[model samples]
Target: MTRLLFAALLAAIPLTAPAAPSDPYPSTYAPVPSPPVLIRNATVLTGSGERLDNADVLMQDGKIAAVGAGLTAPANAQVIDGTGRWVTPGIIDVHSHLGVYPSPGVNAHNDGNEMTSPTTPEVWAEHSITPQDPGFGTALAGGVTTMQLLPGSANLIGGRGVTVRNVYANTYQGMKFPGAPWGVKMACGENPKRVYGGKGSAPSTRMGNVAGYRADFIAAQDYMRAWDKYNAGDKKGDPPSRDLAKETLMGVLKGEILVHIHCYRADEMAIMLDLAKEFGFRISAFHHGVEAYKIADRLAAEGVCGALWADWWGFKMESLDGIQENIALVDRPEKGCAIVHSDSSEGIQRLNQEAAKVMGNARRVNIDIPPERAIRWLTQNPARALGIGDRTGTLAPGKMADVVLWNGTPFSVYAKAEKVFMDGALMYDRGDKSRQPVSDFMLGQEAAP
Candidate 1:
């Protein structure tokens, strides 16, 4: 009777979905896809190094379903006449501080850096992001579909950088780019040494900076070993005491997270590469690499990207060696991964023009660079650095429908983004103000010009 009762209870039990792993922070990005779209008769510059004249691009069910001439769209698809326009993959900025240090930059808005400690991987940039920052609309209007919001360089390890879509949303989680790998904001050279040196901290000098990194990474290695042993059932006890900072470092050592270091001089970057090798971690990119041209070949050989400014330099001692042709020279090397990143809000609105400046400088030096190749610096290269190359950064089948329709050749000085699409949704339309996003902060103010 007891066995029969147990069997009957088991048979009557209800089934439920298995819960997801306990990720302390989770993304809540719910993309709202638009109706199917068909763009025809446009000059298309694919970010992966291809240009098509009078081509057609079809977006269906939130993905690029077709790319070719003479493509047909569904009866309900919105066919946009792209004649006399330029179409390309959406712009992706690998470095930005939009939400962390948002607009109306007041004392209260300064939350980008955790200068209390030199090693602060425990903090997250997402936690400081203010979704209401009117900066999102400007970037969107500039055709920036995605960007990486990073912490300030006032510390040795600032925190984890967050990749977000440039969509105007209510929460940072909604703005986060889905499945993008987290980046650890680490600093080399003057920023960290100067900030801590004055405080009489241990890392008060250049050598001390290296020592600080080694100590933290060593602790991380020990922490990772302890957790591994526990998980393997070799050592039976309470799990290794959780250190939030070490947890993030362990992710870097395991290559699950990318390491983005703020560095300028070639020698410091080279030293950073050595430190990464010693700690068994890989640096994915070097931000503000003003002198990267000096060691461009080595960076290319290691598959590390140089996320550089076009010409802005010489404001600081470390950036003194910066050259106006930094971007072009770095890109001149074989297998070089060069990206034009705007660390300033004003610069973010003109990244296309920034790349154009680089091309013009290259021309003076007699270097041959085309529109298709230069567009890669703004799109595919940044996407690869943020680890989203497979999903977007190119207008091809099976990729996200993130594209821009420009009023003229994107490399031209007077070019402007006529329409910007994310997931096939018309996020920004110059002809229709209603199509552009109006954040809560801009409700009573003048519309974005």
Candidate 2:
């Protein structure tokens, strides 16, 4: 009778979802079908600091079958003469606002920041993604295969950032990367202070920012303890009420979600690092860290990556000390993870050129950043920072065949991506008008040619 009564009580209480949802807004991405192909006699930058001249790349069954010299093509493969071209893994932009703050920028499209509160971790950047934002096609034309779409830096704990494939889809879910982890966006330095300060808020100063983080994390800790107790069967009462913001924070505490913070000053980054230590969460990368060079060695030792612009600076006080050699300096440490990222849509179209600018600056300092090594800023390092390093960054056997055929050395201003492939499928061709993807939003709006 006691067992029967307990079963009835359990049935009367609502069943709560698991701590981590397995498929809430799950990815529905599907790679475009492709066939075997071979590109012979090209200069290949493997994206792992290895360059091979007169090499051949094989693509079959939606993966990089092989990369070598004097390799024979399969009988059914379409052969291409890569005589004067260069091949590199497709570019991956670690910082981007492509869909959230999409093109034809207007008041209606301004959905990036949920500024009603300072700590709104419940919000998600993917919810604002408009797949028909013409930016995707333009980015693809520039050889970008994957990108992390993030929220604007307006709040202390802004929201969740999503990693997505630069592919055309009717819905953002179809563009989401299947197994990519979510990133929580946090900001430090000027933006948050200035924003809330003018509004007569608590976090009008840097200390206030630190306090805000601590308070929220403390609440999250309590929330986690409640759930943990229930899961461990230590609590006989009903399971604790779920808080979306706390759930997101608990994901960070559990190392399920990556932390990407927007910080400019070195001291503030150090403070953030200390805060992470207090909360027991890991930071994946620091975005737009102009002062990252000041603590390059420490960041390398901690295994944190710096996703920064090549030369952008001086527009704001925090960015005033930024130098052109920032990327190179941050990359000086033995284990330094440096990535060149485009936070602007216009810059996203010329990420290779941005890396070239860094290369030029590094050369002036006698840093000697070669093409092979510099390519890591665009490919491997960004992939590692975004938690997709094992799958898509380098051209390796069994990896995604995201390759770009450049008309010349990619570092040169004259170079262009002649052909762009994602998962062995030809997604863009510079010479083929039909192959160019036009967004549905741009269909009838294109000016007459």
Candidate 1 TM-score versus the reference: 0.94
Give candidate 2's error at residue 124 in angstroms: 0.5
Q: Given candidate 1, what's the lDDT at residue 89?
A: 93
Q: What stretches of model 2 exceed 4 Å from their correct place?
A: 1-21, 234-236, 447-449
TM-score of each: 0.94, 0.94
Taken over the whole model, the C-alpha lDDT of each candidate is 0.87, 0.90
User: What is residue 396's positional error in candidate 1, in angstroms?
Assistant: 1.5
lDDT of 2 by residue, 30-106 (tens): 66666798999999999999999999999998799999998888888988899989999999998999999988999
Name the best candidate (by lDDT).
2
